[model samples]
Target: MDLPNTEAVGAIVALLLARTKRGDGMKPWVRLVVPLCIAVAWVHSPALAQQPAKDPRIGFLWSGVAEAAAVRMNAFLEGVRGALRAQGDHIELVARIADGNQARLPTLAAELVAGKVDVLFAAGPAAVRAARAASPSVPIVALDLETDPIEAGLIAGLSHPGGNLTGVFFDFPDFGAKWLQLLRDAAPKLSRLAVFWDPSTGPMQLKAVEAVAGSMDVHLSVIEVIDVGNIEEAFRTAAKQKVDGLLVLSSPIFGSSPAMIADLALRDRLPAIMLFPEFAQTGGLLAYGPNLIDLFRQSGTMTGKVLAGTAPADLPVERPARFQLIVNLRTARTLGLDIPPSLLIRADQVIE
Candidate 1:
């Protein structure tokens, strides 16, 4: 058998070592390994001539329901996987369910960074913030984050992330207007609207609620539930105030407790509008917002670009171009209200 060229192997190894050292900011002792690696490459070429290069390892750090709830989060993960598979990259997922535990994030971030993943998928704002804190150089694609990336200093702007982070923004503020409009249209006689949110998880939700509450001519009742234990108390207050309609703010907490909240609303016979279709389908009256599956698929597109050697900063942050409005006819019927035919026609989906 003809042996591979040792000189060529040495040259390739040396080139790789230089790039690695520069990128990793290695100390002198570690830097000395470059020469040693090249020497070994020259000597080992004959035996390792046909060895396949190890595929790059990518990591996914998911918050919310990508690992559990089996909602739109799962769709986003599948979409991201499909995109990376098209580009021939190997990916692995590490999920941490804070389950509303904000304190666990730093530890979770440490674990992913310790694994030395080539790239990362940060699934929500909390996960993204954690990943950013953990790794400064590794490329990150953020999915479903509901903050203004610029204001949060996650990116320089929508058009330029200007760092190792970039992906799609959920544009929560714009959706706030749409969500309020959906609420008003669903219950035209809505007098007082109670807004429910988890302060730890729903900053954008609260801001949006305040911004449009006045224009809709409905008295806004800001109900905050900082922990899982406070949810019932928050609802009791809403009920006592005789809130005509309830608008559940979009948040990781709401996403986590969709079934429970939906059931409570149905049992209480409250006319509720939400921001996700799955929430409305479970028992809430309606939902109006972007399709999370499509957003996740778009996140996959960004992952593909990063794996293809494009910098995360080079890929501009994307705003969802499409949105969806869904109404649950069963919930409408239970509430003893007739949904206008025009509204039904405008719905992307009407769950009967």
Candidate 2:
């Protein structure tokens, strides 16, 4: 039941007191009943009643294919549900999937913003860039693995974003170099290495690998895969170069097809390393990097904060706290390469 307006209640109370003070010839029952009836009518007045609150709407912008990105989407939803459960709040999710088409992100982001989402959750660098372009004021929680938010001028710093954008980011260049080191450990004669890269993810990971190639005495053959169609050609080029090993950098396109990439690597007899544990689990020789599913979950938690009235500028940017090294002994044996015992001991999981 809605309470009467303060002004109306005060006026009625004042009238009753004034009548009593004036000693009006009215029965005590009549005076009390009259005021109670007026108060009840005022509360039931339509103009004075409070309206119900609308649920918050959250926008999800993804650059990967929906069918292939199911696990990541589920993890993110779990986080959002967990965070909002405490407040007994419900949210309407408005998702815009690019289906691995980078060009469609801008239009999809614009549509989400026009739909009036309270907060936007962007997956991958392409989607993040599109969301920022579509709305300058919308709160954006990003899950990006390929670019440095600071270098890209997306945020002020890690501790304080100082803008309407903040979430999980993987910016450590050395982390890319570590993938190369792991590949070398699995295949000691990794002289010529093929780098599978997606230009849309920016050049952070590619540049990181390039910077240490000369020092490591390794020659790099960068094969850019912009579209899903280019994946097969990338492997063909790697085969033409007769590369000893492959280093698959981070990108939504590559992340969406771990099994396909692993199968191709095995067919080419290439010892390969990728940044997702799923790649190694599927058949790739080695995988070492942040857990992407957990990173998406973290982004969802941040989105929940935004919906709970926390400004994006006040929320601190975060990095993936947990990383995993996965080694596939079956794949190593299939490639005729023996993974070092030292490397296997450090692995979080070893699949045979």
Best by TM-score: 2
Least well predicted 10-residue stretch by lDDT in candidate 1: 27-36
On a 0 to 100 scale, what is the lDDT of residue 236 in model 1? 92
lDDT of 2 by residue, 248-280 (tens): 999988888888899999989899999988899
Distance from true position, residue 85, model 2, in Å? 1.9
- In model 2, the worst 10-residue window by lDDT is 27-36
Q: lDDT of model 2 at residue 16?
A: 19
Give the TM-scores of the predictions, in the order they appear. Answer: 0.78, 0.85
Please write out the lDDT profile of model 1 over residues 92-138, one tens digit for every residue: 44344444554555666677678776678776677788889998998
Clashing pairs in 2: none
Q: What lDDT would each prediction earn against the true structure?
A: 0.68, 0.81
Clashes of 2: 0
Off by over 4 Å in 2: 1-51
